[model samples]
Target: MDEDNWDKLDEEEDEEEGDFSEPETTTSTEPTSNDYMAGAILANGIIWLWLQSLQMFSGFTSRISPSILADFTAVTIVIAGFISSQQVAKRSERNQLIVALRSALYSWAGSLFMMLTSPNASITFSLILLVCLLAGGVLGSYMLIQMRINERKRKLQASS
Candidate 1:
């Protein structure tokens, strides 16, 4: 019985050592294709919002009401967040980044909605929304670039 116990302990130690000896690789950390798609959608939405905001500021409000534009932007962001959250299989750095992007977008959307609905809305609130949107866009772009790089590394590792 003592000999069997010693053998089991040796086996466990060997397994632990083996686990530590493996090289760190992109395969373990790379985001799925769904993450890539979500990031792309977020980037495009940011661009769209920026253009719409610009149009509103440039005297195109005669065609579309600002309230309608704000509501559309909010809906777009909520849909993107829902789709991106659905794509996550497990918690990971990629998932965390997506969550952060979603949060930022949601905050911007809420600010826009409040500004449009409030009687005391001012230019300061609009400027804050613009800043948040720009910051979120930059963050989304960074995450997307990181995901692309990791994917390339994974492909190269597979081919080699």
Candidate 2:
């Protein structure tokens, strides 16, 4: 009876080890939505930069003029925002800053792309996009800071 119990215990331990290993494999292999979004944004930014560089190299000075610098800045900001958002999302923390940053980045990137592709874009459209981006950035940052303060207050109360 003693030998049989030892064998059974060993078998159960092996099964437990297998269960732990399976989760590690599955979690590592599964790509989250944030990962996909970050990849897409990075790819889009790289392609845009590459196209601009090509235009400049081909003597398309108008297409690669001073405005190209602004587009580059927008791309950099958007990519950084996407990366930051992904990191924050992984923490499972709902943050307003991340949400607002994403919103602002998307608006800015889209507006920059539109302006670049259509230099004749209406002034009204440009103004609207800029306003929306600014509003989202301000609102998001403010809300997130408030949330952090609230969380700290709650924690303090609980500890007391």
Candidate 3:
């Protein structure tokens, strides 16, 4: 057969033998609840360590008592993270964002609760928590909005 005909034949054979062995590398480019959980765990852990070091070296274990509530909060954060991560894996970016927002809200609530319930939680520490929560909310909201806008633009472009 001529070179051109030979090439056509090869193409036809390739079409029949499907490339089924190639795994679909599906990934969520968006960060999910599980990501939040991981970050919270890390941050909380660092805080815990810092607290511990201060107590050990400086003898400043003043008002922060290691309580059941603290453990519960940590567990809750992890659980929320897990739920969000699952949503992300299912390609639910909005749900993931919702979970993140909820977590931030909860953090704010927890901070407020701490301030009211514990006399030892200093004003300075409370303000720091508030700042952290505000920053997280702003950043998460911005990301969510951007994702939504981008998706809308893509759909419009595609339809056009």
For lDDT, the strongest prediction is: 1
Q: Which of the two, 1 or 3, has more TM-score?
A: 3
Give lDDT tens digits, candidate 1, residues 1-160: 9999999999999999999996866656544555545544554465456555756676666567778866665445444443433333223445555554554454455456655766777887566455544454445545555766899999999999
In candidate 1 the C-alpha lDDT for residue 25 amounts to 62
In model 1, the Cα lDDT at residue 21 comes to 93
TM-score of every prediction relative to native: 0.33, 0.37, 0.37
Off by over 4 Å in 3: 1-105, 112-120
Residue-wise C-alpha lDDT for candidate 2, range 92-141, written one tens digit per residue = 34554555455455545555675677656677655644554445455545
TM-score of 3: 0.37
In the order shown, what is each candidate's alpha-carbon RMSD?
12.7, 12.0, 11.2
What residue pairs clash in candidate 2, if any at all? none
